[model samples]
Target chain A: MDRLSVPTSRPLTRLIEALNRMPGIGPKMAQRLAYYLLRASAEEAQTLAEAIVAVKEEAVLCAICQNTADTSPCTLCQDPTRDRSLICVVEEPLDVLALERSGAFKGLYHVLHGCISPIDGVGPEDLKVRELLARIHDGEVQEVIMATNPNLEGEATSMYVQRLLSPLGVKVSRLARGLPFGGDVEYADEVTLSRALQDRHSL
Target chain B: MLGGTRLGEADRLVTLYTQRRGKVRAVVRGALRPRSRLGGHIQPLSHCQLMLTESKGLDVVTGCQIIGPLFPMREDLVHHARGFYLMELIDCFCPEGLENPALFSLLVDTLEHLCLGEGGERVLRRFEVRLLDITGFRPELHCCLGCQQALEPVTNYLSPSAGGLLCRACAPEQSPVHSVSVNTVKVLRLLREADMETVNRLNLAPDLAAELEAALRSYIQYVLERSIKSGVWLERLRREFGPNGALGGPQNGR
Candidate 1:
């Protein structure tokens, strides 16, 4: 009820509250960041704000891969050097980057964005799934590599997608599994994930 | 419901909407060509408010307003795999054409956990089990399904085939039951009751996680018979994380 309680800079406090709502950031960290931004040089502070604003405004979603891009088609879909026949379906845009970093895959990708989650209530329709079927239809997509994560949701999504694409008569394959370049097989699971590693024969 | 096809020389855009079978997808043609209007903004995990329209029985994504990139599942292979696994599980359990509100919110929250924190594997496992529970395949975790005995301090005996605990008296007669602690059973029970946000906040050690995983896998396998292909890869991926990172690496039967 006093002057301190009725702070003069309510807007600043409110901003901190908003920042605190972000993932991994707590009230203390948010407060510290808010203060840091406030004390920062005007140019630096303004630039940070602009960067945030720019991603929201300037960035766009590529029409093909559903990946975030500055332009429509995105770089990977446009690249001539990549293999056009292979289509790797993944759960999110970042998966493209993860596969890219592996330097193992040369094919194009389809970003499903989210997988089928039952408890939380996200079904296949909530994801970019149907477009994937359409991709198989029009594109000369010879082989579809399902790159969904190896969890229940990812497996269900992959299986559903595989079944959907099966009618199209496409060659649907999963990623190779084994002990990573340096890993153990003893700690595997009982389902297909471990079995894949156990049965991984030499190419 | 988000799906895409190669639209241009280097561009692609996907449209998502509620599907008759519970998901939908759309493509933007020529979206990848350098000169095309749709560029890097539409890749996986970009949460954008989109402008969409229906044409030729498909939902088309006309435009997008970027919200910001979510980075948790994108930062590495492990996180990526974990996220996909979570999403796919939700997909498998939901019925087509039904707008499952809890599943949708679960996905958003699951991704939020994946991107913002560590221990994604545990969070994911808990989610998987919870998904099964909600979807109605909950294996009886508490008392013995056969004996109807009160499972206090759950002394090591879960029969996947039987779908619940097997007391020592019963274990000798049946195939060797998987061993799980009372604490682990409590955790499983908790998974059945707790919300995803609450589930994500808890700690799940590797050994306990391994026990729960075996019991859960066995129960699911007994029901489904054949194994899910993704389940195998998930095991290998878990091994990749090392023992410290191993919440529940493979070792289903081993």
Candidate 2:
């Protein structure tokens, strides 16, 4: 190894390596974060480390919706005021947060954890699809709103789930696709423009 | 084109199989954002014309225009799965920067055929045979590998390791082999020589289709030294839904 490979200490090098393994964090960014943590006070460093450990130790996937939480069912699944008939399916737990922030729907959610991506070797069996099917079979869910991202893999996953749910007698719907707010019509692609027109609502 | 992966928070890394440049992976800036114009045009299974700028590591996508969306393929589960399988085969077999217009045309044609939902598994069999021919792994369907003798109408063994057919007497003890029917061999030969239109009109019984699928799938797995992910999904769909079980969606009839 060269001089550039050497860190201030072994622990700092180890921290940088660990952080570099995280998604979207390159080696340079990892090193920068590691140094930032090193310069902080001992109390601050300890608190940060404790928080990381606590997240791993305390977090559990909710058995019902598969969302990460401290409880098996999570607060959303346990909430009695939410609509029982409508279940929105999303790709990840983070999506559940995004949807919750929108405050648009009063129904519960189902986290798929991932979409069907064959290139990545991820199939439907790898997802929480069986759990979702079982949940739907309970006869409470009347409609499943597919909120999967509007990508090829996402759409394929949504279609797959919809096929399974159709035979189960539950109504399935996908989120509307069109131009985003503030998006320029001139800049939009033909597909987007067409979809926007097709999915347009009556004024 | 094939598909894309999330690069970072808002960017995407898309893989495209083009006519002149072959397989190219480029980064699309802000492609994950809701309003980015580039995101809508790069959907997998779409035939798109893209303008790319040379960069240090990966090329940057500057512009995109969809030539054909293959909308029907994306709307149906069976077509979607078959289309993905074709993309996966090209991705695995075709190396980057190698030009092969014939293979590219074969892919686009097969995708279009799948979109029409006319040929069913026949389209895939033709694709596998053509792909093998293009990649220089064309299986020895007409002759036996062991004796270099012409194959008979009787049952033959396909040796994935030997990269061809083996007669009953010549089935190699040194390597693994799969039982291939005479109809499977005849179909493979026909698929290799016939045009896409011919393949679209040609149909096989359920048992023959299964045999053809199994034989070619084994050969592909052997040549690649790995199992195809989409193949597994296709097989699962067949088992769960029956031979053509992945049909049905809002856009497709049950």
Candidate 3:
């Protein structure tokens, strides 16, 4: 029998179910969260609810890079110090945050929203690819760094974009693949090991 | 086995084709984060042995051991595209929860051949014929679909719409029947029953390979009722790589 199915108020059960639907939240965790919310003061519950509502109502996709932002052009795109001549193409908004955390890339970013996966029925047309092309055509962009994930679909997406950008005179480059910092060679797979060997640098 | 997709930040949803259970999608926690233990093993087309823990909706991938990642095939653009096409074809044709060890072995062998740098067109043609055979969609190469007569050693038509071959006399006038040469028909027949060794030894002229590819692709399209996406990428890569392409070229180094 499901633990959540035990006698409970309708509103409490509803909250548990809603929380259960979220990623990484199982029934047990959902029940705990729901009961915790039930015990919290009304003002605390109202604040949490209002924050969720505000995020949906206020957060918008930036017109330039398609990243989630409160304004048309995100702060990264509008920032005067960022390199305007280069663009880093990634798969999702989360990737934008990951790259930003690295503090390595100073160029602007274009989120494709998703990768090209035929099994999932996601194609090039489904992504924000045309917008990227248009950005390249209309802007002073000279180089595009394909920062899509290091997977099959990611490689395919980067190659597809590279082909499209090749004739347009934009120098296309993919992120360098090697041993991740602190990654042990003994545990590295053949693909990663081979990549690391091929991309080895002179000290 | 095919690869996986990132799920919920640190987790990965891997799709595997098992001999006993067929296609299984399992979630592996902490697969995407740095220093992930499952990172190197569950890559796309890795051919790993997975231990799954049953759960509601989707199973969790608890353990994995890499048998073969087919790294060489993944390194080249053309080969990678072909490998992707093969995986996609299997995923489309084979339904979930259906056990067919023969088909599983066929996939493994075909992927191995692709990694070994065998002629891609021949390997693909052989894989198509064998896949159709296992799936019960094998086209009749010897007899005519319309008249049931033995096909003459002349130019005959392979009709996708009719689900097989048609003789010159039985072929519809305006229908989209692909004309196949005597050599093409013979090669297709050879691929159906022959092992990879036998098929590998047979060198196909560029024109014949193209003909075989078109005919088989049409039949596959007919079977699926929709166009294959990887096929489009394969065609584009073929054009880019040229006739002699990157079949035996230097590894693409990922």
Judged by DockQ, which candidate is best? 2
- What C-alpha lDDT, on a 0 to 100 scale, does residue A67 get in candidate 2? 93
Relative to the true structure, candidate 1 reaches a TM of 0.47
Model 3 chain A lDDT-worst window of ten: A116-125
Q: Between the candidate structures 1 and 2, which one is better when assessed by TM-score? A: 2
Of 1 and 3, the candidate ranking higher by lDDT: 3
Candidate 3 Cα errors over 4 Å, as ranges: A1-40, B7-9, B18-25, B49-65, B95-101, B154-163, B168-183, B194-211, B221-227, B232-254
TM-score of 2: 0.95
| Alpha-carbon local distance difference test for all models | 0.63, 0.86, 0.83
Q: Estimate each model's TM-score.
A: 0.47, 0.95, 0.81
Query: Which residue ranges in model 2 land beyond 4 Å of their true spot?
Result: A2-4, B247-254
The better candidate by DockQ, 1 or 3, is: 3
Candidate 2 chain B, poorest ten consecutive residues by summed lDDT: B245-254
How many angstroms is residue B19 displaced in model 3 relative to the true structure, after the best TM-score fit? 5.9
Q: What class would a CAPRI assessor give candidate 3's docking?
A: acceptable
Query: lDDT, candidate 2, residue A129?
Result: 99
lDDT of 3 by residue, A1-203 (tens): 44676778878888998999998787888989998999999999999999999999999999999999999898999999999999999999999999999999999999999997755657788999999999999859999999998887888788778868988999999998777798777777667777889889999
Each candidate: fraction of true contacts kept?
0.00, 0.68, 0.28
